[model samples]
Target: MDEPEPERKVNGMKSIFEEEIKKIQDEIDIFKSGSPNHIAIISEPYSRVEHIYNRILGDNSQKINNIQIFNPVKDTDFFSNFYSNQDIIMMQNCQYLFSRKCCGFAILEEFLDILFSSNKMYITGWNKFAWNYLKEISNIESMFQEIITVPELNSKTIMNLIMSDVSDKVTFIDDRVSEDKKFICFEECLIRMPLSNKEVNISEIKFNFNALKRKKNNKTMEDIQKEAFMDITTLAGGKYDVARKIWKKSLKDGEVRLSRIPQPSEVEISDIDELFILGNILAMDGIDFDELSSIVKNDSLLKQKLYNLVNKGLIEDSDRFYKIYPEAVNSVIDELEKNRMVW
Candidate 1:
């Protein structure tokens, strides 16, 4: 499924960099001690990797502070009121594409240019194009302290450059052979990391489901619908209404007791059409209003009932769409699948 783009704004590039610089400065202040820590932060807009970074920086005890720089054109609301620190420096990583504008790459290049001209930061590595640019503009070897990139050179080439006052720190960090470039699986990378350094207890930051349920129960609706509209009630209401209807039908048939809420063992699978709807929804990739309408097409009775349950919070609008809450779906499914109906 295609994902929707975040809201946009004009001149988003300028705003994005400005925000990054501001956030970097703010984070520095928050983490800065007499002795500063060296931190590296990286993120891509499409990946949820930034969430991990956020969790890391939010640890008040950690010495490192980092920020993910992005082009705000895609999502203008994303970086508002970000962390305030002055010790952090922002760098943009950019790449080129034939069809679309590479905003991130452009911004990174711009920042690098300004930093280099002001002698604020040293260039550690460069591809051929960047190396040529530096050479044409100035004596690159004399200008920078180090160069970390992949290239072949003899001892004579190095000696000659140094004799011409072109010596700088040059080293190769990659020792891989040309033919050894192959795709590495995620598991391989995980195995390489030290297990002792990994954080095993992540429950501290995770949301408590029980706490969320309590909060939901406490929220009082300010107004109620004038009539029992299919779409007007909460998901919980829809489930209650469906259960009530089933209960009444069973009573009329003299098959079950109305006073006691019938357990799963007491009810037959065939009697729970609402349960079937729930199952189908739980199976769907993303249950939205449109998907539900498509599934219950022309069946106003089912649609209205389901909508009411959603409105009443009996079933939740999980994932902010027409999809049934996963918890509700699982509960209903478990009941239908039970061997001992009442048990």
Candidate 2:
């Protein structure tokens, strides 16, 4: 993990921002024409949020000509210096301005109010998980006139997006399956708990028994790579960054193997404190270790839990900032909801 992540320098790789540029063009034009429209762009993490923001500034034909792009990640005073001459404000990575304070309701209330009232068009980016949490607690979604999400890609789209990054570098040598495979018995697989009327826990997990049949489909080497690429994309929930990580992990001996595909490491949660920390981290999208340590009542215990979470692969840290993996976002959200850490 000490290795610094190299910049994504793959050739022929389509920028995630390219497809959505024209989709929001009309709205951007409308905003420029004095129509009050605050556009909110939300996406999962590792979705290249910065890249998208740059693309907006770089794409000349989008019609919002000669607008100063303001990234508030470092300059908290950027908004304070706003003048009427500036018609558009690009607020990138707004999550950094927020924390777990007051369940994050108190984070952007005043600034959002200002943006809504002013004639200026505010284009903002946010992590979907954090955005949803804010919408629930602060009713912030209503403030935005228009919201667009970076699309969750399928196998075909993922191939078109990132295939060039791996093509010609590695050849498909063999086909492999999951690391462990066994026929699951219906009775054993069915999970049940008593209804609320009774003193019991009732949880039923239904499996598609019919979908278990393995079909006979012969594929060429190129087709198999496409299939593997799609599988990784699906497993990673079409997150381009996470899909690339899984792809690189699965490649061995200059070949791709089905079994090498990765999943979030499962951790046994006996303590409720760990869940609390994780929920807040998800709510903020990411938090610095120092800031988190200050927030937790017990610094030593928080450090221990953070180490455990990192070792278990439920979360990863970079330069003391920690964030959940894209594939695990849903599961983390589920855990938070189940624990009543979030409403």
Candidate 3:
């Protein structure tokens, strides 16, 4: 009888864990199914749109009927072929809608004008530049039945734009989520369409309080990120991206550099986990550690593993605390992949 009590307690805990697991599973289902008929993902050139696409389709077994529109309808055949293709059921008419690789506001405005003129729903992606430019122009804002914005970076200009138009007429969906890509419902006009005045007032009051907190936290993250990259106009300095490319090229070069050949005594294998941690830090230099920690605390375990490697002579630490162990770096990456640590 005493053992049964313990077993019951264990079962109770298991049930609670199972409930949480179910909640997450339900959320995932919402993510896959709740994706609207049309979505506009304003993203940068190298943004994570592909990652989003992969998550929606791969996880949920849903297909995005896409019509990639980079530059405007340069070739009528291209546009015609895309629209005419009926294979795209989920995405009735998806288009890239870009004038060039890096088209700015003028290009996006024209895209809105086209949307306003038509009733067909479409999915498009734009960078932060294009999103802000569109936000500044109110005429463009009224054109969309629903607007879902995914913030890639924290920019004041962008935040202000988000605050301005996230209203009743528009449903604002925030795609910043914990696991994988998620869409957070900020404002859903349809929900309040039939509510009474008192109900609407109460909802508005509650929503305002929540919005204030969201905005404050969001702004803080943005400010911290901005401070880190203050020196690099293009972002922490063009050197960060450049350095990454150099490192990758060096790795794939097939032969170690004579300059990189470490003496036997100097060579040591550092922690594999540290490689990912250091790789991320190196990817975008000038980011503050405080901000990085807030975002990547899950990756902190690599620090201890990395310290062990330093003693093994496989890795070396720079005066700046950045690790420079060649063999350890390679091993860490391999181990991370082997263990499926990457998302």
Candidate 4:
């Protein structure tokens, strides 16, 4: 009898930071050639800069033999045992060096002083929001010679990244009916009249070319796969972790369905305290209750406010550490930017 075919399944994918790793390695090469400047890798809060740092060290173990790594948890005393003999220093989650409260800059100032005076080549990972905020308030931007911002993954890259882990063939299914997958959509918008400067509400018809193409041509297997991955990419905002989360949720019985991808619910934040709390959590990537309380300092209503945020599905509490929900990161960022809480 012939050997049985492997069962179709969707397996968890390892994060791929190919371009990011290349850029970091290039900077390391330049540093090895007597360059005095340090390197900084900045990314969105949910992007998980630690993974990139690990990838760099893993890929270039022989080249970077004498490197020290540190991940600070609090605003002070975390870097007391720095190795002076190491030529390379890798610091992940540099955003934790400072809090957003009064007198929070003491530790950050100290760290910068050491960074500036030290002759060793430093490679630091930072949260983009925190980096931008620190740049405005401090001279942190000038300290790093090479600042590499991780760009969002495109649809094709996301598809490859997610599919790389699968051991067997998977199917893509488009189960939506004609009405559900309409090519045309109407959106409400305010436009000024040509003569009068009066604003008017009008419905603008938008055409989804991809949907139209699918409807026009005979749907092929490749078409379905592309559509499913595109939906996942859009919902994830091209972030690798977010896209992987969505892909896992969308996969059922070895079939990826476009309609199964989840979208974040609309979150409205009118309270100033809630907005600041969200921004602070994002800037730090994740914060424990004690640290958050130190910055917020609203003991009476802190618990209730956190409860409200969790109930609204805007934030998540894991082992007393509060973090913006993965699905809600983009929404939270937009809200914070609108409120001028984070850059």
Per-candidate TM-scores read 0.20, 0.73, 0.30, 0.81
| Model 3: residue 192 alpha-carbon error in angstroms | 73
The C-alpha local distance difference test score for the whole of candidate 2 amounts to 0.65
Better of 1 and 3 by lDDT: 3
**Residue by residue across 288-335, what tens digits does model 2's lDDT show?**
776686568678899899898888677888877888866676566566
> Can you tell me which runs of candidate 4 are displaced by over 4 Å?
1-19, 32-35, 62-76, 180-215
Writing each residue's lDDT as its tens digit, candidate 4 over 11-86 gives 2335556677777777777775334578888999656455566666655544443223232355445655454555
Kindly give the stretch of ten consecutive residues in candidate 2 with the minimal lDDT sum: 1-10
Which candidate, 2 or 3, has the higher TM-score?
Answer: 2
Error of 4 at 296 (Å): 1.1
RMSD of 2: 9.0
Candidate 3, residue 318: CA error in Å? 35
lDDT of each: 0.33, 0.65, 0.36, 0.76
Q: Write the per-residue lDDT of candidate 3 for residues 140-200, one digit (tens) a residue.
A: 4455434444433323332232234334332222223323122333432334436554333
lDDT of 1 by residue, 1-343 (tens): 2221222211111012233333444545544333433222222111122222333234321333233332122332423312334333322221110001233234334433543444122112122232333345445345433322222222233223222332333221222233323322122122223556563422223345555554465422211111111221121122322322432333333223222222232223343545555544433322455445544554576666676667644356645454534224324435535732211
Please give the TM-score that candidate 4 achieves against the real structure.
Answer: 0.81
Best by TM-score: 4
lDDT of 1: 0.33
Give the better candidate number (1 or 4) by TM-score. Answer: 4
TM-score of candidate 2 versus the correct structure, residues matched by position: 0.73
